[model samples]
Target: MSTDNITKEKFVLTITADSIKSTDPRFDINNLGLGDNYKALDAKFQNASGTIITRDYKKGEHRNTNQTMAKLAFQLFETQIINLPVEVKEKFPVYKENVDSELRYGIYSSVEDFNRYRKTREYMQYHYGDGKVFVIYSWNVFSTILFVQECLKRFGEQGDKFILTYREKDIKESEAETLESNVQKELDKPISEYRNPYSRKLIESKNIIFRGAPGTGKTYLARQIAADIVSDGYYDTYESLSEEQKQQIEFVQFHPSYDYSDFVEGLRPRINDGVMLFDLQDGIFKKFIAKARANYENSLKNPEVIEKETLVQEEIISFLNEVEFGVDQFKTIKGSIFYISSVDDKYIYITIPENNIVNKLSISIDEIKQMLESGQEFKQIKDITRFFGKLFATQEYFYNFPIFKAIRGSRKKNIKPTISTEKLKKYIFIIDEINRGEISKIFGELFFAIDPSYRGRLGEVTTQYSSMNSKVEKFYIPENVYIIGTMNDIDRSVDSFDFAMRRRFRFIEIKADSTTAMLDELSEDNKDSNVLDNDALKDEAMKRMDNLNKAIIGVDGLNENYQIGASYFLKLKTLTFNQLWEDYLRPLLQEYIQGLYNEDEIMTTFANAYGYNETAEGEADEAFESEG
Candidate 1:
């Protein structure tokens, strides 16, 4: 075989594509391929599954080389499979030094556009077709590869964001599985094995509490459950989730002082321009529940209705932004001239400057939204008898119609709007150490709302600060919102959780022995990669954990609640078996036996079971005594 032209591609470092696996008599990229030198080569790309389409360029073979790939790229552009950005010189930053001098790709919309530019005509003609554009919107073959390489490096820096810009409508179903679908399945496989049951239970129950001995990975497990549920089994771990996916889950750690003011809505103090003011603010849970409710309700809405509602809301906001507060004057249906006075989240207040009355009119933003959504734009007020079931008085119509028309006519439609589809999403709210706080105080009215049977409107309750709200609609938890609470069975504060709240949640006991599967993780990516070494450690860990928990249950006052967990055994990663006992296990066990009558005796039994050498310690103590 010839080796002169054999070379690696610049852009595609690895293509572990599942799509390529379906090839008839599937071959690896390393098997056989012609490289830059136009001669047969082996192992041009190192990937096991997918092949590297080597960017072979020869002076005489410009038209023949990579013509198939170049044509496919052009087809993707024509079908709007992936829209190319309008080329800007500044946007294409110079990639790392590939071959001495820096070069940026020359991208043009079409061949005629490419011909108009005289600068890179010679460069384009030699490497690619004389007047054609190729992959990454570049006319030069090498530049196309360089473009992918440069942008891939930058996108890789974004950590969890595996960014791919595309429009949803542009994609058409293909024979091969998408890279996204494949990657999601790969990410979610391990998680589903362990936490899928927990995720399912949380969804079915609506509220769940994981009760376990300390260090049994209750909090960690809750996060995995949330990630699994939120990503629809695509992502397994919380840390693996993209930022947008993470928005569907909320984590809160409860403490002694956590109350309704922190969990639900409350009067929070704030400082304005000079004086201090108390404002009614929705707390974390309320805010998150509201978001979940909106998502759930929006999913149920007719797409056309949702789109129009969005358009009206957007237009109203735009109108508000353009209007000068207390300056812009407009006529009502009754020829009343009102100047815009102020605007809040719900209402837009306006004052008739020429009126004898001092009061300002409060126009309902919701009403205008309803009018545009369901009501018509009649030229006369008599034609509008009623809007959204509210029989508006003549004066009421005078106050609203003019503002409605102004907002209705001001629609710009700038955004490529996205509306919610009928597929409802699950939102998980995980509260760690839920019993640590006074549950009655923290949950307040929410205790009624969170019940599984009464999940939706049936469970609605007036919140503590409902009186302060502009529109006090009954607050309810959405059907899609699930709560996962983790509690240590031995925590003193567990008594603070009332029977009412207890009945609402399905409690599952997580034992020290129950979490043994997590110990399997320690064997991976540790000091030794040998199968025997890893297996030996895992077996030893499982054996010691079993022995220790057996001894723990034997203690009269102690039971499974005080048993040592697999999390403690995970110290086998950095600590010896004896060191693990002396440091983490010993201290925690000592605390459990602090005032017990048989304290020393119980600890001695535990040491013996865990292979701790008390006799060796006794000998060392005796030697020190003799020296003294």
Candidate 2:
């Protein structure tokens, strides 16, 4: 149960030389003590700093010694002191800490000899290669080097020979550490401090699908999970993020006709130079991937250099102009065709009165700019523009001028890598009703790149329409980009999704039990004082819903897989019980039972289960009471 003794180990050192072919074998370098150079070896050792040095000479006898070498292979580990396998790290608690401290682990050898032996592929298989005298340096590499130097000096006397040795020991955890004790300490931590196990699985898998019935907060939770990843851990609820942080997440939906042109890069018709022509345009996923890649590459750069690339005022002005220019169309008093002629610091001048008369009318942009600069509301400009004494006044048309222009900046400049506050800033692409799309047809060649194992630069591919663009030949999904999808499992459309996509995505089911509480939070307060308070209605609604689902699952043609989720009851805050049953629930039940052989009996059973009868009402009350 203790790791005190596990960290300690003993090692022994040995030295030997390779044999040489000779007519008189006794005179070879291998036969050191018997050779004539034995006298010179003694003299060479005498010159060493040691007090006395001598060599023993055995006449006419070849001394052969095969000494044991200590195990120092574990020293090669760089990130940690111990070169333990991943299995060992997972099995032992002491090895799991982010405890990084200075510890000894390395292999040392004669550079010349290692290079010489490296020519042969057989010798290359060895960790340090076949050196003349390989030395593995552990904790006492400095002392070991001095010892080897003296040996090399004496050995050189026999011939032009070199001696080298490397020795190093792998240390795990700390000098004073125990695996059992560490694991016990970790277990002692409160449950709130421990991360969710599923988060780790999601990180490893990279792609996930949240399959359930409609309105289970699948898209909502996807944004939160995506934020958690980029922040390195769950920082707070998604609502707490600053406007800038929220930009890192994206949401999209998929339908039957959605194809590669809408999800990846494709040639699209655009009015370029007054001529309609197809030009390459990046789709939502591709655009997000490009942003993520830029952030990732910028993270590796020096912050000072990024700071030198100043945020000039001209660039900001240009950006503002682009945002305003995007609003090509406008609305007027007659409700049709007004073109935004020009947008300047003072006014948004436009040509108005479509199809009959053409004239210029200007609305002051100062109010909108003030609303942006100071987070204060401005009084609605009354009687702003008048034409023919009609007194035209549309607040929305004048106020909301800068469309698609949401900008947030950090106070500090280049304080962190990846351009100011962003480092490895991730982008999440959430595909709602994922199964409704033709998966293979929509993703095109991106299917290979989207695979979890093949993510990042390793999976880069030349896109199908790459030839259309002069500069770009390849595209890749960065590691910081993630995909989350949601669908109803019972939908017939689910069957049309490609098998290849199914294998790539980790499927996580959102069930009624996990999401029904959302309804209670929504119906917490009654909007109108005249209306009856329905704070407790969610429980009653859920009980009837659960009972209906049970009947649906037990039906002859159906099973638990097709059971309805509690999302159907979310509108109880404003809807009456009678309205929900008579208008919505009854018709939905009828549709579910329409194709069944015993249609009449099935409808009767469903209606009763949904609290249409006295027996069903009693059962619902009993279930709710027991749950409470």
Query: For candidate 2, lDDT tens digit of each residue in 126-232?
Result: 12223223323211112222223333333323332222222222333221123223322332222233233444446646789988755456665576566665455
Model 1 gets an lDDT of: 0.64
List the candidate 1 regions with Cα displacement exceeding 4 Å.
Answer: 1-195, 320-405, 412-422, 528-536, 571-579, 613-628
**What is the Cα-based TM-score of model 2?**
0.52
Q: Model 1, range 469-509, lDDT digits (tens) per residue?
A: 44456899877788999999989888667899998999999
Write down the TM-score for model 1. 0.57
The local distance difference test score of each candidate is: 0.64, 0.51
Model 1: colliding residue pairs: 5-37
Poorly placed runs, candidate 2 (over 4 Å): 1-201, 214-217, 227-240, 304-421, 528-535, 613-628
Superposed by TM-score, candidate 1 places the C-alpha of residue 178 at a distance from the truth, in angstroms, of 33
Who wins the TM-score comparison? Answer: 1
Summed backbone clashes in each candidate are 1, 14
